[model samples]
Target: MKKPFNSKLFFFILATLFGVILSLPTFLQTQGPKIILGLDLQGGLNLLLGVKSEEAIKVRYATLASALNHYSIEEQILLDKLVVGEDNLSFELLDSNEKSKIDKYLSQQEGLEIVEKDLQYTLALSANEKINLENFAIEQAIGNIRNRLDQFGLSEPSVIKQGSDTILVQLPGIKTQEEEQRALDLISKGGHLQMMAVDEARNARVATMSEREAQSYGDVILPFINNPQQTILLKAIPILDGSMLTDARAAYDNNGQPIINFTLNSQGGKIFADFSGKNVGNRMAVVLDGKVYSAPVIRERIGGGSGQISGGFSVSEASDIAIALRSGALPAPIFLLEKRSVGPSLGADSIRASLIALISGAVLVILFMVFYYGIAGVIANLAMVVNILLVVAVMALFGATLTLPGMAGIILTVGMAVDANVIINERIREGFRAGENFIKSMENGYMNASRAIFDSNLTSLIAAVLLYVFGTGAIKGFAITMSIGIIASVITAIVGTHGIFRFLQNSIMKSGNYALWFGYKQQVYKRKL
Candidate 1:
């Protein structure tokens, strides 16, 4: 003697209504969390980039050389020979007294193999260390590229490792050439900011000095960013690098030109203060990737960990640089192995095809359920619709991307959504033939069908989880949609349908018509002598 619609049904209806509300913004293209179309579903740039991981080893070697050179100058240790080899650097100590200092420096280093014959020492990376560095370079490149894309305000850009030495990048909504070029530059920007002293004693003769002569004097000739024809000679060793940068932003200067303002971490702040305090009246060149942006004379101590780079950049260029700096430098340079731009028209065609397939599949499933199960089939169809809505609503709530493969997953789920109800309906039909009451029949039906539904959905969920964990790009998208769809189907087809049947149970029992309610004829008993 319960109400026609019980509290269970009320809660079920509320959940469906909540799903509808959550999905509305996405379907209507309004604000709030919405599903993003993937590269195949929307026009975008697809790139296969090869990371030059080998260059990482060279960079490490060069870094060691720089550190050694800087230490020699700081400690005033004379050296007879200082040469950077292809795999290592070799230097001979001219003063025997400095051997202890050099040995201590070598001890503090992390990964290096050193050989000494009298005063000359050779240093190189161990085989395992080199291999590890190369592998780390690839991972670091992927992380940096993803971080840059995320900060560039691009929507759901895909950056994944394709293989041991390559990356696959999918940037959605990059239609124009300008956008593509900007994205390319942003991803490739090394962001190797260095602050080097402008070798004041020899800078005056930079125009006439040869490259070899500058190297002999521990200086490097770098071109100016604004005018590449002009060059400045800076000390080879950098006083500071971008490794310490905590944040960077594009801002306008007093002259209305765009500039990059940056902040540094605690260690960098202390170094900046000490250097500026001591180097007053000396120029310090702001170098980035072998190009000097500015060389301003340090007039007084600069503190607070803040600095600016002024290079006459446009707003867009400045913004890109700022984003790159904030995202950190790539461990190695990446070259484009392949580039493909997906056209919007192609995406339109794909979307149309996918929609046609999904709708067609769902319609056929809905019709089959209605035809076979009759009134009970109608309830199952209702559950299928609610299941689909919940899947979409949850994906939109999470801002997940929708790809073509993902659409295919939803289509597959549509056909599978009513499976639980199919089992339950058959069980109840069997009960009706065995002379069971309407309420007891449904209760037995659900109880018997529960295990099958649980086992099937549980196995499917496990597969989806594995697919998500090990699969890449499109496979991951497919896995996500299928996972969501399966969970929603369990809720709608199993739990929701049971509640709905309970809500309609009293009417069916009072009507005493199993044929209309369950699409089956009831057996009539005749008295016999």
Candidate 2:
């Protein structure tokens, strides 16, 4: 009755081989595990950023005021004392008759409500408009930060919104303080780059004008990044901005110094070509966050929309700038509310402690199983080892990240695996007391014990799924490992251990030995026919 080729045995062998192959890279120390380690385990930066929502509101009003200025010039309306407030823009009409005209202009605008009181006209966003604007700003900030991180080349970063105006960032495996700061700078920089024409006449006249007097001319004087003492006068209206950029990268200049090379979209390309073609000799300032990085003269019409920003930058600085530029600007400024860096040495210590706990737990479990059930216990111990290997291999295959909590999950799985063997071995002892033959007793034990095993693991799997859905960071890591471990345990307990018992049964039958290895005395009792 011995079968030469058993499907269950074949499956068990194949799965073990697959698990070994999947885990070989990590075992050999040739390469790291396919599963990544989280920030807590690997050591990196954790940042909490609060978005300046008021800044977004201010920028919105500034843009509206610029539009209103254009309308006033075009319509030839004389308005006085224009004021920009936190939520509204107000102006007084010199003539009351112009109220109707202003009302008509405001009615045409979307998301704006016009109000008139005491000859003062106020334009403000409606309630829905305010909510929409705030949400849009937050969503835009998230998108911009994700793009920046992607370009910065960090793998498996967690960039998520913590609350209405807060963002949580966790970057794993960053080792140096300089690198961490560089990443923080790249994420928070607004990166509002602009190309503006230099105003030579105003530049000369601004030397005599007071700061307040110079502001009335609607021109901005910004210091150069390389030489802060030297300043340039640029028109407030930009000829081009970062919004039109399509790509940017870091490159070396002719002198081997680092610079950022950028390209524009088709429309921006045509605009630059037209502007540079007409003003070939004038200097166009490359401004970023109100600081002029460079002001190069137009030698010829730069038709390709390609340009470089060079200002004595190191390689890493230039690379950061290029990444920020390519990712676009944040909708609003982000202030760091809290920052914590985990040192790699601490992470190493943690790993050491977790490994010690795991090895000690596994050794104790293996010894107990072997001492309790004799040969059957040894089979279960073997299955437990395979269970752990398969769990790790599954994690590697799925590219899951492991954390301290995840290591705890694995240890818990070892106990769960032993639980399965205990159930089956106890059922086998009961069947032996009922006077069943070796093969029949083993068959009944596996059949009767599998139902309880399936039900318990099923409920645990459901809980793991819920945890994964609702948890964050390390909790999620725990859920993922626990989930994978549960599945691997079921396979190893039912299929792997059973296959070994089947092989043992065949060998015992051939040797004419009907000894029970269930660690219990057999009783001569009548079978319930």
Candidate 3:
């Protein structure tokens, strides 16, 4: 016969496990951990931009249009014929009949610099420049896509350019799907970003509407420069325009006021400088669509020729404005390509399936423990409950999103968590039958089990870590949940199970209740009568 194991140890282990588990939520959620949110769990928006080849071709022709216009070249007179083909632009000189007139006209265009080679007049457009313009437009489209996403107020959005003509946008955790889609749809429209005169009456500028009215507009669009007279409304055209801006930045003036600084490309610079020189002291408005972004008073001939638009802005706001300008406005109207919604019913189904899997797994394990080890199996079952409670608490504290894959990890941990306890309990029972005292048997059991426990767990942990490193999205979620659960299980098994047994040992000593606990007496083991 064997003395029953100590109840004091069991209670202590139970208390310690429960206490730690209960406190985990507090520890993890103290400052709100970086918990992952799924696209469905956090209803947000997704935008896929299909860049039309036609749009790019149209833009190319538009650039050619501007070039022709700049030289005062009559489209019909100088250009013999214009043929806008699908993938190429072809034009013949009107006076192929007059070689002298064509030569003289080509001489006046500064950068166009056409040269006659092998009897064919070829415009010397730099290959690099053409490539750069194409790349720049694509980049600008990317920028516009980003701005549109920002307007939706989604935190940590994923927006990137996919090819020369495609953009992919994923905004997780957005509040309204419709609003997010609406904002993104507006992006491909590429609303105009222009400089226009501020229409005082039409402008949403008033000294002091009621505080409520003021609040309604969320912060009135303030002027970049304090001037009432010159307000140009910068805007975007329905057709693709304004590829002229080469660079833009944020800086401070001589008085140290925040300002948006911009310079057009050489061709655009020529036009801007000329415009500034002619419109000196007039009000030039920077407009986007129909809204006034900045209205600056043209002080002097701005030929040298970069100009600044100063406004009352914090550093962040100014940087955003600068980025918006550099990125260029959106182009071509956009339509919603796709829309999706994940109802709560699906989420409920996920939760239900997860719970069923976990419970089914746990129940089978508990049944096996009881059938195999009898009384010791009961203790292990109780410990399993404690383990699960702790895992839940830790998850709540960490604010971890419980995805279906994460649920699988939790259930897997439940099975593995009790393996160490099973090893040690079986070892101790065998030691008792082999003529060892309680303390000796218990010490030997844990000491011998440590290596096997450690070896198995370390291997599991390594696998979990590797999964976490390589996996993305849902796979990563599983890895994280498994890793955390495994760690918690090891801790609870070693320290937690030890505490439970220790309390049991102490209780047996105090109450002389070993027989009741283990279902055997010391006398019954003797003399084999």
Q: Largest lDDT belongs to which candidate?
A: 1
| Residue 99, model 1, lDDT | 95
Per-residue lDDT of 1-529 in model 3, one digit per residue for the tens?
3244455355545655664655554446544334444454454555666654335434554355445434433333455323333343344554656566656766664435355643345454445545555666666667676765565355545566655566666666655656554554445545444444333443444443443443233222333333543333221111113566766677887877777787766766666666666667666666444444555677876665455556565665455556656666554334444545545456567767777888999999988877666555677777777766666666665656556677788898889878888888767766666766666666788888878888988898899999978765466668877887777666667666766666566554455333343333342211111
lDDT of 1 by residue, 190-290 (tens): 88887888999988899999999988876789999989989999877677788889999999999999999999999778778878998999999888777
Candidate 2 vs candidate 3: which has greater lDDT?
A: 2
Per TM-score, the best of the predicted structures is 1
Worst 10 residues of 3 by lDDT: 232-241
Per-residue error (Å), model 1, residue 96: 4.7
Could you tell me the TM-score of candidate 2? Answer: 0.82
Per-residue lDDT of model 2, residues 79-124, tens digit only: 7756666688877788777777777777888898888888788888
Instruction: Show where candidate 1 strays beyond 4 Å.
Output: 1-4, 65-85, 90-98, 520-529
- Compute the lDDT of residue 66 as modeled in candidate 3: 44
Which sequence of candidate numbers ranks them by TM-score, best first? 1, 2, 3
- TM-scores of the candidates in the order shown: 0.94, 0.82, 0.52
- Report lDDT (Cα) of residue 221, candidate 2: 79
- Which residue pairs clash in candidate 1? none
